[model samples]
Target: MRKALRLTALAGLFMASFAQAATPIDVYRDPNCGCCKSWIKYLEANGFSVNDHVEPNMSALKQRLGVAPRLPPCHTAVIGGKFVEGHVPVAQIRELEKHPELRGIAVPGMPAGSPGMEMGQAAQAYQVIGLTQDGTDEVLASYPASSTQ
Candidate 1:
């Protein structure tokens, strides 16, 4: 019984360390964008280690990253070699990391109530779009507007 308990404790420790081993994300955003900062804070609060890069030329960076032109762009993030554009939520970001078939994901425009774009009692419906390996846009998830008046 003691040996079994010791092995269980060891397994728990290993699991804890693995959980903390998430890849650090590099976020590039305009220096003057407040929403980007808020998004970074949200990520940090959700247990992500964020490396914030205050970019000077956002359009050029977005272009270089191959962000879809149809997808409304804002701050850009790279995690595990996948581009995360706009205000993607933490859940979708995790899903993106797990899907090797997707090139990237985006929340498109800064819809209200998404992560950092929160507006008190006002939320706009939005879709989380995934850029597939073939460069096609796929709706990965959709969020409804807040019902709170």
Candidate 2:
């Protein structure tokens, strides 16, 4: 009976940790885009459960999601009912969790060194922009181009 109780407690903790880490997200991307797949892997590693929606018409999908044309990226995601575009870092997602007032966030273009766009030792200056419901945006985070970037 003691063993059973211990197992049950372990199971409960496991489920809670999984829930806390995983933020369910539906990703929209082109089936042929390798970078997009890499980005998905980044999210999974960061504890997000991603559902891929591979479609040839990426533009249409973005349009349907009300993604601003100003912030264009190879992929987009719906998470916690908020839009997440491009290779946003896991850390930024944590920030988003804090700012429930914002609608979503995006990294305009796929900059090198950003999660999936990583190239050999090259990181470009990039900004993670936050979007409001009315389509206004602000820079939530900025990353400098660095050797470690």
Candidate 3:
């Protein structure tokens, strides 16, 4: 009985870990950006299944998707009905999953220390902004910038 119980607990633990892995995220980015690739790698390392699409005209894509210019970034993603921009933290993405009403999230410009943008030792200060369907935005979280500048 003891051995059976231990096996059951172990199985449960494994299942829990699997469930916590990041979900599928469709990321659209410019083909020439190195930071964008790094960001994709970050998501993959954290369990996110990414379907990456490289486009030369990211501006047109953004415009069609209703993304605000002020919140633009090196990449864009659509996951669980929320649009994600830039090197957004995996934790924030998970949090957004809980709020189904949000239209999306944006990190704006490529600030240092943001996932793939990390450089140097000092982190830059940046904000993660959430947008609604109509284009209004709200500050969701603030993170330290990349060390490189």
lDDT of 2 at 54: 84
Candidate 3 residues lying further than 4 Å off, grouped into runs, are 1-22, 145-149
Ranking by TM-score: 1, 2, 3
Across residues 1-149, which tens digit of lDDT does each residue of candidate 3 receive? 99999999999999788867648999998889999899999999898989999888999988887788888877998887668988899988989977665788888888777789876667779898888766788889998544344
Q: After superposition, how far is residue 42 of candidate 2 from its true place, in Å?
A: 0.9
Give the lowest summed-lDDT range of ten residues in model 1: 15-24
Residue 86 lDDT in model 1? 90
Off by over 4 Å in 2: 1-21
Of 1 and 3, which scores higher on TM-score? 1
Native RMSD of candidate 3 (Å): 4.0
Q: What residue pairs clash in candidate 2, if any at all?
A: none
Q: In model 1, which regions exceed 4 Å deviation?
A: 1-22
TM-score of model 1 vs. true structure? 0.83
lDDT per residue (tens digit) for residues 1-149 in model 1: 99999999999999799668755899999989999999999998887889999999988887887888887468999998889999999999988867888989999878988999885857899999999889988899999987665
Worst 10 residues of 2 by lDDT: 93-102
Model 3 residue 8 distance off true place after TM-score fit, in angstroms: 18
Candidate 3 residue pairs that clash: 112-146, 113-146, 119-148, 122-147, 123-145, 124-144, 124-145, 124-146, 125-145
- TM-scores of all predicted structures: 0.83, 0.82, 0.80
- Residues 1-149, model 2: lDDT tens digits: 99999999999999899878787889998878999999999988888888999888988877877778998788888877777889889888777877776788899888988999886877889999998877788889999988863
lDDT of the structure predicted as candidate 3: 0.85
Work out candidate 2's RMSD over C-alphas. Answer: 3.3
Clashes of 3: 9
